[model samples]
Target: MRKTLPLIIFITLTGTMYALGQSAKAIIPLGGNAWVTGKATITDDGLTNWENPQDAISIYFRVDKAAELTFALRVRVPEGKSKISVTIGKHTFSKQVANTGFDTLSIGKVMLQPGYIKVDLKGISRSGNVYADVTDLIVEGVQSANELTYVRTGSSFHFGRRGPSVHLRYNIPQEIKKDVKWFYNEITVPQKMDVIGSYFMADGFSGGYFGMQVNSDTERRVLFSVWSPFNTDDPKSIPDSLRIKLLTKGDKVHGGEFGDEGSGGQSYLLYPWQAGKTYAFLLEAAPDKLYNSTTYTAWFKETGTDKWLLIASFSRPQTFGYLTDLYSFVENFEPDNGDKIRMAYYTNQWLGDSAGKWHAVTGAKYTGDETARKNYRKDYSGGLKDGRLYLRNGGFFDDLTPLNQKLEYRTSLPPPMIDFNQLPR
Candidate 1:
């Protein structure tokens, strides 16, 4: 059986103007059934079911023009089953209730042609019993023209049971001489699993430049490895420095032993993360360096090996001063790098210093053995012996020969396979 609450609406000024220079108009009202014995408080915090037997609720509003839309709703289901739905005209978006506590739902850019909008809530019950509560609903109007657009790569990268499609967005700052690359990813999971995703960026001179790793599931441990040129401010210098960081979900995961400091060392930093949590990686690069800032999240589930999936990459480029960010989603990822598991990070580049001196840092290798992956630590570092070196000329701004030295490599000792049922969904 399903029960629903009365319709409620609320509106606030958003300071949005149309092309005609008129303030955009929207209609909203304080939500909930006013006739109820106790007032149903509705705020941005989300919706809650105060009365157990109450039916579902629906809210309606209107937009005068075509625009993008964003909204939030809170729902609480103490027992049984319930769901919230967002309806724009005839199209309805809905999600099933999982947790008994309050859960927040957010919908990204949706095109709203001038029409009526309605959000409906339905109480789900098994054996003719309904158990659920709902409260606050907030809606915001966004301009369609202002939304950032992206190009879909059609190709997808598969990790574990999860598969995430690739999208790329490029931005070139006016002043910087370097390119800032932005790699956008959309990950879809059929089920769920414990998962970790990361990207390695490097030049030849320094061993590896910068590494960013994100763990989507907090309950299980994840192993990460990377090899690159050193880290330096000069674009003309070959990579010679290498640094690696190990991360874990529970306590601090140990990273392998790093080489001596300055030569190419390793460091460990404990990041506050929870099990069954999803996180995003925002990596930025200016003319001379790259770094990470802020993190967004999603929930983690354990399902068959085919359940957990990830879509991520390190291809975005940024101008000298501007920052570029990349995002990844992990759902139902489990750690079971069965035999044939292959993981690797590789890169190559040439740099010319301010002295007009050009040196090529080529043939760099930072490989991790089987033991490294098996006993994965939160903090560790080491060097590879297979790396190379090269030399180039000055006054030459373009040289494909030296720049082409950059390459990436990966070999799975056991090979990667989709082990869906092996995970906890």
Candidate 2:
């Protein structure tokens, strides 16, 4: 018993640490301090054992149920036993690793429970250098897989090597209505995404944006606003005849005198939105009869509801005419402060004109801000998966070279068919 006293103590400590870690939530990279023993040192790039004979890194995670788990990792082990040992509770999986360069490894089918599960990656008993470098760790095949897939998260500050904070957009290919009157789209918000960006926008930022967002953990709101061609912080500075007017703001909508991105305009907020539910937005734009202004009206109807409630209506006296560009984007606004992943689903996009006919928007491409393209080593990723366009940018990486998969011009549908008479005003 005396001879095995040290072994028992080590086991007890490891189990205790892992239990504590499992109780909380964290994203543990190799360089983070979630280890239990073995004196493992992790550089900015990876975890390696240069002096110690025994080394290990331990992390804990929680799951809602007993299901299959996948471990996605970039690893390299050269001239050692050529293997790494992974421990979950009492089960162990010995996986063969590459000898050089990083390779993505998938180790899965590990049974997990509805509570805390500790994973231990330990060095094998061998003669050569025992080392492994990990980059990405993803847990899939869960009860909330749909919600999890939409989590938008990445490194935010890339030491001035950051990607453009832009949107994943789809234009109507060609202008359908010379004088447009209506635009429509259906959107669904994921249940647990901490932040929901302006997922839907008309005419991009130059024109304006209408979106549903979780501004903060507790604040859920629908945001709608348009940009003013004039540059001024004071809303009153613009002449009353030239400034935009909020014709009507729906119940619970509250906003006035907002400014950002070198443009000053108006905004409205509506609250108590439901997650995991579909919501439809119908936008109407027409020139005001009395003034040389254009009125934009937003109508919203939640799924399972009968009547469309008018959200807000604003008229821009200086700007007039149709929706020039339309698209959607996903982003992590507080990437540096929060670990909450967010995702928005955009579908059933449609457009209309004065003729009272609606056309579907069929094609879109993957593109990022010019800043990211200029430093396009590994800061942005935009592409299509399962007919859906996605944009993922910014993440912490020691060597961001592997994030260099930039795909463009991913069209989802055939050319859009536009046939509508210009409805008379």
Clashes, model 1: 91
Candidate 1 lDDT, 312-346, residue by residue in tens: 11211221232232111111122211111112212
Per-candidate TM-score against the hidden true structure: 0.22, 0.53
Please report the candidate that would top TM-score against the real structure: 2
Candidate 2 weakest ten by summed lDDT: 9-18
Query: In model 2, what is the error at residue 38, expressed in angstroms?
Result: 26
Q: How does residue 4 of candidate 1 score in lDDT?
A: 75
Q: Kindly list the per-residue Cα lDDT of model 2 for residues 1-425, writing each as its tens digit.
A: 45532222111221111112112112234332233355665443446663354665654344545666656555666665466677776678888775567676766657665544556776655445555656434454443322111111232222122223445455553557455577776666656543433233322423567767666557766677766556676555766666667777777777575653544455556566777887776677877657667777776667667666656777777676777666666544432222223445566666776776666666565555544443322334445555654444443221222223433333344322332232111
Model 1 gets an lDDT of 0.29
Question: How does each model score on lDDT?
Answer: 0.29, 0.52
